[model samples]
Target: MDVLIIDDDPTSVFLAKLLLSSTGLFDKLTTYQNPVDALSFIKVQLVDNQLPQVILLDINMPLIDGWQLLDALMPYQAQIQAKYWK
Candidate 1:
């Protein structure tokens, strides 16, 4: 399974990687320090049907929070397309 980590804290991301990596449960692990970049990645992945099986999102972020990210992706609940936002 694939996993995504979207947190602004480098320490948190590091610790999360340490813990999750130790378990050796995921096939692909990706991390992003910026919410916008993470969102864009998710959008591309969603379009390609490669969305991560799990996403470790930070509730508190600078530009966009976890809830906002989820809100943006909500469009996928029906039918997703790259044009949804662009």
Candidate 2:
């Protein structure tokens, strides 16, 4: 499984990565401090059929909060949900 973590706090990201890595369940793990960057990456991944199986998002981000990200992804909801259902 692939997982993507989006949070502004470096320590939180590091800890999450450490814990998830220790689980040894994920095949791929990615972290992004900037929600915009994460969104761009996700868009490309959607095209390549490499979307992350799980997205851990932080709602309190500065520029773009989790809600905003969800709204931004509204157009791709069907595709994203399809991947999730798989």
Candidate 3:
């Protein structure tokens, strides 16, 4: 499975990566400190068949928070849900 971590804190991101990596569950792990960048990456992934199976998002971010990210992803909700449902 692929995992995406979106958080502004480097320490948090590092710790999450360490913990998740230790589980040996994810085939791909991507981290982004900026929500905007994360959103952009997600958009690209949506069209590429490379979407993450799990998304660990931060509610507090500089530009786009978790809620905002969810809103931004609304247009693709069906696609995302279908991907996970499969």
Please report, as a residue range, the 10-residue window in candidate 1 with the lowest summed lDDT. 77-86
Residue pairs whose backbone atoms clash in candidate 2: none
Off by over 4 Å in 1: 79-86
Q: In candidate 3, what are the lDDT values of residues 1-86, reduced to their tens digit?
A: 89999999999999999999899999999999999999999999999978888999999999878999999999998998887786
List where candidate 3 sits over 4 angstroms from the true fold: none
- Deviation of model 2 at 76, angstroms: 0.6
* TM-scores for all predictions: 0.88, 0.93, 0.94
Clash count for candidate 1 is 0
The local lDDT score (0 to 100) that residue 82 gets in candidate 3 is 86
Q: Best lDDT goes to which candidate? A: 3
lDDT-better candidate, 1 vs 3: 3
Per-residue CA lDDT of model 1 for 1-86, tens digit only, reads 89999999999999999999999999999999999999999989877888887889999999999899889888786554353434
lDDT of 2 by residue, 1-86 (tens): 99999999999999999999899999999999999999999899999989888899999998999999989989998987787776
Best by TM-score: 3
For each candidate, C-alpha RMSD in Å?
A: 5.0, 1.1, 1.0
